[model samples]
Target: MSTAAQDHPAAPSPGPRAALAVMAVLAELSFVGASMLAWAPLILLQAIFLGPTVAAVVGVAFVLGTWWVVQPPAPPAPVLLRREQAPALFAALDALRERLDAPPLHGVALVDELNAAARLSGGFLSLVGGRRTLLLGVPLLRLLGPQEALAVIAHELGHFSRHHGRLGHWIYIVRAKWDVYLDSDPAHDSGIDRLRRWIASAFLPRFIRLSMQRSRACEFEADALAARACDATSLVQSLARLELADALMRDGLRTRLHELQAASIRPPAAFWDLVADSLRDEPAARQAATLEAGSRRPARRNDSHPPLADRAGALGEPVAPPSWTDAPCAGESLLGPLWRGTFDGANARWAEQIAPAWRLRHLHLAALRAGPDPADTAIDPLQHTLQRLQADDEIAASEQSLAALRQHAQSQPDDAPAQYALGLALLARERPEGIEQVRVAIRLDRRFAVAGYGAILSQLELHGSEGELSEFTRRRALAAEKLESLDTGLWQHLLKEELAAPPPWARALLLEAIAEDRALDACWVLRTERSNDAGQRFTLNIFVARVCHDLMAADEVDEDLLAARYGSYLRTLFPHNELARVMLRFDTEVFHPPLLERFARLPGCEIRRPTRPINVDVVRIDSL
Candidate 1:
């Protein structure tokens, strides 16, 4: 345990806490009462108007739907740990449970996140003696000391205190789930659905506001109980150090992962080890000072946790320093002798899952170095940093890269990719000339227009003149408005226009693109409204077709595969800098045969037929 344990400090229970707690329980009860009998009145009306049979079917459907929606999500199967496996950990939990006068835990689980939570085991039934499953995050164990881990559990278990009762706990559980779960959609506009929408949009928001107030109050109570169960000092330290650990994971891990892609390497994911070691051994003075994670910021709208600074202040002067000892981490001590075996096994599987995405990035990096190709046209040069510039590793690499981009743009004055890439590079270096390049990029390629406008807004937000942000924000808003209108116009004409033949050049390109596919169907192209300001841009919605009589043979053409291949062929048919930005729409007809049957009727759409039919001599390969 910690070197010392102070007597329970004053836990703030502002008078609003009790009132709001009562409000949340009442809100939940009100909704539950309305929900249970919600369908009865509608069914009664249907029975009076139609008949018993029709009403019976509708009532049954309603009941089944309710059952489906209310069924609690199943716990993650992979990372579940039993008491048999982690006896010491379970023993510690048992002691904490008795100390706090809480119900026995239903289960223990682990997840990939850098946080911990306690969820009710059964959906609504948890209100009546159904225990909670305490979910421990892997990072919590790997990063914290033993006493700190105990403090984490103590706080989570404090929520299950006997006085808290099943009713309040269950209400909290359902309210949390209902935040995202609503049963209303355009397809189902029945009376019950209208009521569901009302609950979601109106009653739910008010209820959330009330429950959130209660939840914040409960946090104070939980913290007090945790301080009592596992020393106050340990609790304070965990709060501070956990925040620092979170900052490290969020800021550093993504960039580190991206860097590994250069070598196509798959190292064992010892991510928690790196964080733990950093904390245990002082790495940087800057990081040591960053103990608070938005601690001064107020609680967010939906989050139950108050700001860390506020939470620490409420508990009295903090005790934890943003540092760790050379002692074994909480995972080693808490899980007893079985810790490494379990952790290493799980870590290996995580590494395996990381392989595909890691290698994909490697391939992407290689392609960038090799230069852009026909099939790689969709690969925006602006998305990637200058790989060649970084390779030189010279003091003047940034300037050299900018100079190279300038020369390329000068040589190909009309090219969009060169302009866009130059714009992106300049913006990275905080140059004003970037804006001009982006504007020219938008002119040459309408595809980059909205995104270019967004980039301009971002730069302005960072370093604009006093009134420039407001002016440019308005400009962005108008650009977004125009984009929406343009998209609407494109779709409207696409659906209603009569079938027409495509340009000769487009037909030949389509034929060349899909020559290998034996799906033996038809390809059609329809030219639509809205090109670049220079009138050089053309966005064609290409429709590829294959008619099938039986839905059972749906695997004849995989919709996903068709979308990926056909979409690529059309999108990157030519280099982005060479010609117009061509955005193609692949057919959902690959899956929806109904849409395929009616596909030909679209205005200005026509199938590309080969010009020459030659005599063919066929021979059976088996005979040879």
Candidate 2:
């Protein structure tokens, strides 16, 4: 019914399908090999003249091993919306499918991001007739008006119409298999496991790169379909608005979470509505400016879809003005009269999922607020010493505070808080006893999460100064593991809480721990600390930059995406700060001409190539 439908070409070359077929064959062969390994042990037992008892034992072991190795992993359960549950929505989807001349969807679901996608399930059958599911992000639905929402749906439907879903499905399966192989415990990995890893490492990157290229092309084709199905203006506007809406939603959620935590109240039943209200209130001009600023960054090399601005540009001029019409709110339009109730139900479900994490944070805060134990005579004085050490870092003052804290701790051997205070003093003095004292405190009061933070800082300070790369890397990994073992949501809540009402040095320690874990979103929240002190602001910029760099290096997040998303905003805030300029370098390649120029312009800055390439695994300790 549209130009895109009329002009749409047949599916591309069979290269991707052939590749998927080969991979399927390899997977089958691996299963066969596993079966052979399992049967070989039983077969040998029969031929070797072993006793019936030994044969029986070997048979049992082989069967168990085979079952363990060959068992198919449970498929992730999707949050599905059945036709019966939303008859109106299903009918709308059916009409959209008819317009696109596409196969009927097998399922529809909602997710939480500001995006939509089509996915296929059920292994090799996915290449042809597997269940085709459409996942629409609830945020995206809320962000768009009815026409814009339809355009987004049409974009997703375009993928299915063009048969682009199969390659992605197969690639996802192969990559997931590789992930399982790579994540296997080293102690359990035999030669076969090593071989799997090797094969995955060799082929997975190249295959994924090719797949991404195809995905990018698929996005363009999908955009064309959307343009033909809906008016070009609505599609273009939706693309730009989607990016703005995503940013607003994320920032608004973070701001609201902080407010809720400060008020010591759980999120209300109308949480999603609150978030939506915040998004609506965001100034139109500000959103436009943000979109414009974001357009300055280079496009990400590995992103599966083309950048939003590029997509909008490709759509060209609108054929006609949008035919505005009175419509219900997006939620109501999608979910009918039950929209509000469904929204509340989803919010409640999410709350239940996160309650344990919030409970832990609340318990942590309650502990911190409790007064010093009366049994620990030294606690009050030691806390005073800790405050003095934090307030001023002058060597003489620090030494005096350290001596006072140590003396107080010695007077009350059973005081865990005093021991913890002593640990802080020792660390400020760069003494090893600080680490031991903190460990002692942790042993004394097993619930002391702050002591765990202190222990990590002490280890980082000690190992980071050793200058032995291997040891530093090992210690950093161990520290990261320790931090990771803690509940991230709890740590995030604690970090946000402390940052809101900082306790001098405690905030710095929390920031370090957050950066070490590459909690980019938390770093973004903390980076807003508007200190009048230039030095503190500079330090904050460096810390945020380092966290961004670490995320890009360790998590394989695209550097340009990080730059456009966060770096541009930081540059605007800290326009003249040298550290801000230095931080922006993370988004660019090493020895880029612009970065070199920035270094040259800075008075004391120098960029030297390392004698050997530095490993990203080594934790960089920046002085706060």
Candidate 3:
């Protein structure tokens, strides 16, 4: 719908290469014009006596023409997602294909937010790249339910199944990449090229804006397709939730903006002229000033998602109360009967009390027993393989896998392995929700060593220490100690988990204290590179490895140096550990909390209170 598109009946589909060719020709023309201009003074000198007025008019024309051609097009909607990380998510989309009764999408991916959009990465091969990832935002995953989550998965599938993915990708490339070519390059010259470049630079943005309007229509089409693949109600509900979230976010942001305006210490600027003056200044200084202003601001009210009211209305669906009964899920294709066995009482208890891995290992065995039948087989190894990615601390990838697992596990609540695996993921976050989830895992299987250990660890935070803990605390500590003896892996795993907790501040303090204890237990543990006694070395090695995890969690040590030290230290402590021989190991990167706010929610943690509250009024009165 751009003016150019409307005006030129046969405008070439915007493609990066096509734009680049146009830009090249424009550049060549500019170069030629400049060269001609360089000789303009000499050419005019031949007629200087008689043509002063004509030369002045020609000079003005050249300046105006130069200004017209060199303008840049709008930078494409700022690329929010990196292109490289798309492949793995794409793989998940493929794994989901056969499992869905009718595939709505051929691929999946991470985008900027919790919102899902149906766009093609490519045709027939739409499932091939990162572009196909059913992009989910981190915050979005935090809020969505199982049924709504499946609907989104189905919705994205709807795009691919309907061939929307191919067309979407084609348009995306044309709008995004083709526009890039139109403005850049240093060679080629043609009149058509110059005109095209000028048109793209000066007018294509408005044109693309209109195209996006058209794309919005396409969005509706994709939504309808998603509804057809899944339940329309589910898609409608999901969209309503998303719209509400967005509205709430905007309202909160507006409130913050108002507060900042009122709180400013400087005299308010004069209206329009002040705005113009500030706009002319350096962006770096402006950004720095804005950040400084932000630091002095108080917290604003919490916002919810856009009111689902409007979004639901858009779907033309009658508003109905939320129904939690008998939600359809995609579990059978992912985890099979092991998913069912996990929810069993005994297994749930073990999942909660012991390492979630205990249940996971069992579930793996169950899958083997079920044979290659539909009940046992998984449609997507790529989706399931997201476990490693999750373990690696990729939140988006992890959430997708966990979402799929949760969907499948619904059918097999008795699957101790599935419950434990789910619990492990939940506990991994160290949030209240995470604690509840791991708690469920333990309830299913009392002997689950991992869940037991987690519960014990959770309890220690809640009640540990001589005078502070209640009776419950004391018992939980004892239970945790009991589980601690299962294997050296438990302690190592616990330390690893704590290190990965959102903030390492408290965990670091605890680890430092533990290191002190280690030093007291054996001066050689810290001093010697390796130990001679196998039992002593085994204990020391486990502690040291945990220490490494803590330091890494705190981001206190150089990862490369720590890795080298870990290798060298382990050899000294355990010349041969069957567990040590395992190839699976954590990556070398230091894990830090993605946001500072997560620190406030750490479990079994307390922030120091001020000895006395400061009274601002009293202080001001005293100053007077």
Candidate that scores best on TM-score? 1
Question: Please, what is the whole-model Cα lDDT of each candidate in the order they appear?
Answer: 0.59, 0.54, 0.39
Per-residue lDDT of model 1, residues 298-384, tens digit only: 344357776666666666656345566778888888887777876676576666545434444455455456665545443445433
TM-score of 3: 0.28
Judged by lDDT against the true structure, how good is candidate 3? 0.39
Best by lDDT: 1
Candidate 2: deviation at residue 603, Å?
A: 60
In candidate 2, position 88 carries an lDDT of: 72
lDDT of 3 at 401: 61
Q: Which structure is stronger by lDDT: 1 or 2?
A: 1
TM-score of each: 0.60, 0.53, 0.28
Q: Extract clashing residue pairs from model 1.
A: 295-309, 497-603, 498-603, 498-604, 499-603, 499-604, 499-605, 500-604, 500-605
lDDT accuracy of residue 8 in candidate 2: 53
Using TM-score as the measure, what is the rank order of every candidate, best first? 1, 2, 3
Candidate 2 residue pairs in clash (backbone atoms < 3 Å): none
Compose the digit string of candidate 3's lDDT tens values, residues 1-624. Answer: 112211211222456334443543454445446435554775487458668776777766765665444433332232333334434333445554654434443333333344655543423223244343345543343335555665677656655554334544444444553354343441354554565566566755554544454444444544555554455577665564454344333232333322323343222222212222222232544333433332333221111112233334445564433332323222322223432332233233422322222223223323323332344232334323333323322223246766765764565587554555555555543334554555555576544533345453543342234232233344444444443333444323433333222122222222332232211111111211222222222222232221223434564444454444433333322212201211112222221223112323444222221122223222122110
